[model samples]
Target: MNIQEYIESGILEQYALGELDDAQRAQVERMATEHPEVQAELEDVQRALNAYGEAHALTPPPGMKERVLANWQAAIQSEPGQAPAAPATEPVVRQLTPPRSEPAAAEIAPSRVSWSMAAAVALLLLSAAANLVFYNKWKQAENDLAVAQNQQASLASTMQAVNKNLTYRNQELAVLRSEQFKTVALLGTPAAPDARARVLYNPTTKAVYLDVRKLPAPPSGKQYQLWALDQGKPVDAGTLAAATVAGDSLQQMKDIASAQAFAMTVENEGGSPTPTLSTMTVLGKM
Candidate 1:
């Protein structure tokens, strides 16, 4: 075989581009090992290809890769006899030589390498696009679920508060409407001239309920206490909560078997064992 003619046949270019079958590639490698000229020519072909790729590098327009990949895939899937005609586009690389009328059947064609590489790139881009779409949909679903859970929690808390308020109001209404309860008037004393309150007593059940009409706010570390005076001696009733002092609603007190009068006094927090006479705010007889 003429070595110079073989070098000029563009066979080295096909070898560099990996367009040769395994048996043909081994034959080329054997030639390069035996002749320093073939080895040097192979290296030159590889360098030229690298330089050409760099010089022709282009930043494609946005979304162009996807469009080209779609078209390429559709063409590949078409039946062999009914393949779509290629669209007019710029040539990727110039042909090394004009086609001959008759060529050796064993020689690899350049078109095979071009089509193989295009198919590989198209499939890769399509896979990447599919993954991105699925990931975005998953994240959106997670965000929607979080928002729904937060709204449900807020609604549950509001309903609980409303139910508790309704129960308190119902109890207050029942006490006011009962016919068995006797109402008592507690007049304000000189210390709190504007302070006034009332007491409801059920004689049969011995239930006592205190209702403040208007009262002065207790000092810090102090609370209002109710006393039942049975025959002039003060009996401990119960201490008032902050809501009761504000006259928000009626408050149930410790039951009293018998009492001639009811009075209110300011005492230390949680109330004292005995009433403090100087702190008396109101007094009323039943």
Candidate 2:
């Protein structure tokens, strides 16, 4: 590549910006050594960038000058792979100040101080930014964990409800299949013609179940109660607590023996010992 043409292609600008990879950097360094023009251009770019950075740097920390001078001196004296108490061009201190026509002590001190201060400020800014990034990441992790726990709880609750329904269905099927139990149908009265229910009972065990099909919502203070009718007398079996029909519509009622007939009545809350004959909604005989 033509050296002048390569310089104008913007690779030097990238070097000044510190954006070049190791290979690109090596090539640029080699070209600069071979061409004095390339060397001068590279120096001028570095000086301009350094000047811009120094101008905008924050105030230096207290006693920074003393520490910087101490560390720098120790570095040159104790550096490895070099002669101890090294012979050099103008002690390391003299090289710290930017080259100027005056080269006065007053001019050099402030320049060196500014360079040290700029480095300290850069380190502080980097530390603060890193802390902020970590804090945000921690908060996001906590939010994700909370969401996962809620989803887990919802899934567990759904599983429990499914298992409960499955158990009820198994018991319901078992009772229906037994030949020892009798099935009775209760038809709605004129008061509630659309209401219908059924009962399955085992005479041997006196276990009874009521199946409510089409019943209106009960009044706020009233409920439905089941009864066993035998020998012209009505005995309280149990109350069907639910006001409206629910899944399967099957609920175990009070168990009794010698029940020749069955009945249902609308009564007060907690049910009454006797059926309210006036509010009877259904009746059936064996």
State each model's CA lDDT, in order.
0.87, 0.83
**Superposed Cα RMSD, model 1:** 18.4
**Number of the predicted model whose lDDT against the real structure is largest:** 1
TM-score on alpha carbons, each prediction: 0.57, 0.59
> What is the per-residue lDDT of model 1 for residues 23-64, given as tens digits with 9 covering 90 to 100?
988988999999889999998999999998989999999999
Which ranges of candidate 1 are over 4 A from the true structure? 1-130
lDDT of 1: 0.87
